[model samples]
Target: MNEEFVLETKGKNRLIISPNQYCFIKLPSSGIKIVQLRPDGVISLGKFGCFEVNSVLNHPYGETFEIIENKQARAIYTDAFEAGNDDEDLEEENISEAEISSKLLSTDKENKSRLDNRDVNDIGSGVQKLTSVEIELLKKDSELSNKGKGIIEKLIESHTNFNKKTVHSQEKYVKRKQQKFLKVFTIEYLSASNLLRFYTSKDFGKIHELSEESLGLMISLADVRPGGRYLVVDECLGLIVYTMMERMNLQGEIVLIHENEHANLISLKYSDYSEEEIKKFVKTINWLQFFEPDNEKIKFPIKSETEISLLTAQKRSNYYRHKRNAEITNSVIDNVKRGQFDGLIMASTLYLPKLLPKIVDKIGGSRAIVCYSNNKELLNETNHVLLNDVRVINSKILETRVRPYQSIPGKLHPLMTIRSGGGYLLWGLRVIPGDKIKATGRGNKKS
Candidate 1:
């Protein structure tokens, strides 16, 4: 019923960038940078540029903007023409076949009256004539003006054989230059896929190299949805919890078990869900308390407000603290004892053989039990144990990967390099076993 909870429940609108929501800024050359949109703040894009948060406050996601500096205020270019009026305009209107052919020729041949037959070494940096110092000066000037078109044009003019490359090669060269000098960036909403991408670029180890596809599959195989109670053990810095929450849409409850005294849900802080919203859905308890909660040791009588007022301040504080802990411990123990969790999901480093037996019974009958590990060997070991257990059925080990391709027109091909692994999943269904059958001397019979 809270506004933050409702917003996440109903899904965010792509047309508006909300305050405190994580979003992606697609840099011209640096891929994407994920940033939270803080109100009335400045987002510095390093050497590219900086702009006020208000510039993109209510703009639609997926729209690109070019940052431009102003003495009085920061400005952005949203239209193509506003970006530049030099080579881009020329390329559109004044390109000729003869010029393209000439550009494709060698620099020495281009200097002649016509194309000449001569071998030319093209591997080195002999095409451009601008000195590093001069280029840096141009970059400084462009930064001051908050425009890169002029700098790119100047570089192209300085190229010794700008008119000697093929049309496609020329276009590629221009694009590369633009990437180097352009101050443009695109805004994207922070979905699961985007978040994974951001983290993968920053630090793959943090999320255990979990890809977007693998994550989606894990959630689907676990049957995570609204109104379901899930027992989760997340060791990927709360990535699994965030994904589950996205799928659940703030509708269900998550009983999270952690190895530490306090759960390390650091990743969730960057998520769009507020603290209140997350508290409503996620309940965390340490492994010790979850497995061996001493409810009686912490139990105490609930004191009335008037009665507590009579006690000293220090005593009252201690009493309330113990009461809170007791309530939390009791709640966790009661939920585990209920034995009605719809699913059991874990992505921890603990031995699955030892861990599963301790918590597998917490899941309800005909429910899912999914465990994810970056190493296949770990899942393989878990698979064998789950297959032998009578309480689990249809155990399987699965791996999901996403192959990337260079999508250039007329030159499409698989990328030469890509992230090698997307980790693996161990899946099974929890079931209730019936009475066991006993064998007689010559025939099978019930005991």
Candidate 2:
């Protein structure tokens, strides 16, 4: 009750409230929720079964909350409330008045609000009051749509903690919950306008990494032109491909590449493009693997001849070496060739390091783009290395942060929410012979 609990994210369907202070408990997204840090082992409310908060706190996040459901427990008001409600005996057993006061702080505060105090009078009829200026700010956020801004404005109008500070706090809280729950499905072939709508809507389940916002940013940064021969590697469920197709309107085909084991290719299904159209543009390069010979030519090599020569030179009698060498050589040859790419765009963690050099080489004097996570140390190092190379020009790191507005009774505040493992973009155009520059330094005498 008096203790502080930091929320921890588990990989799956679990959120741990406090690790150091109390028992671990399984938390359903919605249920009769109960938390009692005091270690008497049970917190009880009528209809809802008891919960031991300390019992589950010790376990890691993402661990399932396992509670035995009581079948014979008679319903008080509804079965839904029964799931989260605690035993009625705890109210009976409590002795000290002060002990109960702290435990009820959050609940008591909630009860004072009109959302809790008033009975429902048609959900839609509730009036919203917010200033025009505040509404405009939310509208400009890129993360919010017209409807979303309207909702925030309504909260502000209602005067529910509507100040700037409280609004941001509420936004963060809501944003975190949205990310966790909304990112559960894949959206395919979404148009730029529609994609924006979907992101602001927050009804898509869990937003994918290649969600519309990411794609829109990609489109803007890439500066896609019709005639460019682009090399692409996207681990984000072909969301990149959809962007290229919609925006680039290419004269030349796009070469979409990936690591051999990448499962994203299996998920690529577009309503607009036929299988043949997809095949015509995409060339799959299976790393260190061979396929039965086919009549159709693959622009991307299954293995390069230079790689074969390297393997022969090494004289190591190992299958792995031969295969690995071939993949490397093919990628290298592809990257340095001018015709291989007009520009490069990649969104792969494993392929970024090895693939980027080859892409820069192949792009010759074209553009190269690489997306990475902010936590990645290698991206910074890679940018420094590329900048030092004379053939690389205009290297930059770009990041875009999103904050959405939720329509609720309280003021909108940003929750501590940002999609984990996203937010760094390394980009630049390539340089060839004519693009070279010389630098002058002051003459120095030998010391």
Candidate 2 versus truth, CA RMSD in Å, comes to 20.6
lDDT of each: 0.72, 0.42
Top candidate when judged by lDDT against the true structure: 1
**Candidate 2 segments whose C-alpha is farther than 4 A from its true place:** 1-189, 192-211, 249-251, 261-263, 286-340, 351-355, 373-375, 407-421, 433-447
Give candidate 1's TM-score.
0.82
Q: Give the range of the ten consecutive residues with the poorest summed lDDT in model 1.
A: 438-447
Q: What TM-score does each of the candidates earn?
A: 0.82, 0.42
lDDT of 2 by residue, 1-447 (tens): 101111121221123333223222222222222133454355443222344545544444333322233211111211111111222223434222211322232243344333331343322323334455654455344222221324333443464332322323333323332222211111112343443333334433222344445556665666656455566766655656656665644234566665655436533352244465555445554433212123222334344666656765445356456556556445433533424465667666653455466446556355656454333465676776666566666777776656754323344355446444334677776766342232321111110
RMSD to the true structure for each prediction, in A, is 6.3, 20.6
Residue lDDT tens for model 1, 231-344: 999887888888887677788788899987788888788677768778778988887777676643356798999999999999999998989878777877776767678898
